[model samples]
Target: MKQGTKGFVGADETGAGQGATGRARVPAQPGAEDVGRQRNRTRGGGTDAVPGRTGVDGVRGERTHSEPALPRPLPRRPVQRSSVRGQILAALRTALVTGELRPGAVYSAPVLAERFGVSATPVREAMQQLTLEGAVEVVPNRGFRVVERGDRELAELAEVRALIEIPVVLRLARTVPAERWAELRPLAEATIRASSSGCRATYAESDRAFHRAVLALAGNEQLVRIAEDLHRRAQWPLVGSTPGARDGGARLVADAHEHTALLDALIAGDPDAVRSLMEAHFTGAV
Candidate 1:
């Protein structure tokens, strides 16, 4: 979000030059051309003036030519503390999902803050939020340690998501108009693009966006929030798994394609197709 000034200042052409401070120097007097000539001669040490000594005008070794000053660096806008905390929280979540922050590894807030180029306060705040989400636990005097999740826990999270989302999506497919479902096609397409990039973080966000859009049709704010939270938790990589492991990109692309298929089923007013696709999607997610 930092904006910087571009381009350098150019030298003036009408005998006016920029001073060392980047301000424009005063132009020579109109009728005093003779005086200007004499000053130039004195500067060149062609007259009685010494080259490096102070002149009669108290000026010392003034240059005869002007050099363009280097552009000053622009000041960066200060980031808000809340914004910093939110960003750190998001980054930590992505790291958890991608397995960059290995499970059971203790991470100090000060160390993380230094890596993020921010103060420890925001990182600690973000860590506290992650702790609340059960993503990490405090190690007292050490730091926060990532909580390892096994296959069973991941499967259970997926199962909970299926239980919450499948019925709601199926009900909406029957009552919601085709046009309403059609409007979500862009969000569904976004998942495919994100998956194709092979970035788990991008895919995770787009996947949640698509599901949240679909569930929003249910007209239940609480359900959407709860379902999204469960969806996020289910995205964390299994313990000891590396990023993009287990045919990651291929699996993501396959799951992303299912989104468009589910959208098609909803638009076609086929509740059976919607239910089957939803169940399969949840199953494949784990």
Candidate 2:
């Protein structure tokens, strides 16, 4: 498993599907080398090469001016094939969360691969993973389309999360030591910084990190896993809003500050304050 800046979310050390860290463990694909060789052959003007277009350094060039431009600029960091699929998956998630990939828009693998400066195979694999996550869906013979989640769905997700997490957090506050709660202050502060930076993706990870760290103190791995999944689903960008929009940024900073307040309540061993703060936190999450 590759370590991301915010850390991988779900995969365990053995590459099993679930873990405390939340990073995914991707399986290796066979014939990746064959795919690379085929791409090279196409670039070299082999049978796969199209007429009137030349492949330059593995990217097809000389567009006929008929292709539509991407709706927004994608992160263009070039990546290598060694563990490339997971890397691309992470990048695509960041894009999705940050609104670089707009909802209801279609994006083909080749174009995204070109943007990432990698082969299409890894990009396709990454898209497939996104499909499983409900972040995007496959559009037959075209590309993957970002899923548009509505306010109702977001509200329902928040409700489910509250039902699951609020009680557990309140329970932990009564028993956990003040020092244990103190340890999480940095993560709470990190969320504030991420929100202030105006990067939704960064704030999303930090937000998750703070919550996961809090939940992990309960020593219930299964509970942590379940809560994390619900939390992630809730974090998806809502429809009809630009990524990091002004209101959204303000909401994020407000939410980020709640983490610290929640921590303070926990440290004070005040379950009443914890309950109140947690309720407000989830309510405002929508």
Q: Which candidate comes out best when scored by TM-score?
A: 1
Worst 10 residues of 1 by lDDT: 61-70
Reference-based TM-score, model 2: 0.70
Off by over 4 Å in 2: 1-82, 246-248
| Highest lDDT model number | 1
lDDT of 2 by residue, 1-286 (tens): 3676745344465567745576774665648677787667665556666665554344445543333555567768755664899899989989988889989999999999999999999999999988987899999999999999988988898889999999888888778889988998899999999989988889999999999998898899999998887887787787887878849579989999999988888898999999999888988893
List lDDT for all candidates, in order: 0.86, 0.84
Per-residue alpha-carbon lDDT of model 1 for 14-96, expressed as tens digits?
43587878677776664567767766666665755553455446675464333234456866778699998999999999998
Q: Name model 1 segments beyond 4 Å from true.
A: 1-79
> Could you tell me the lDDT of residue 213 within candidate 1?
90
lDDT of 1: 0.86
The window of 10 residues in a row where model 2 has the poorest summed lDDT is: 58-67
**Could you tell me the TM-score of candidate 1?**
0.71
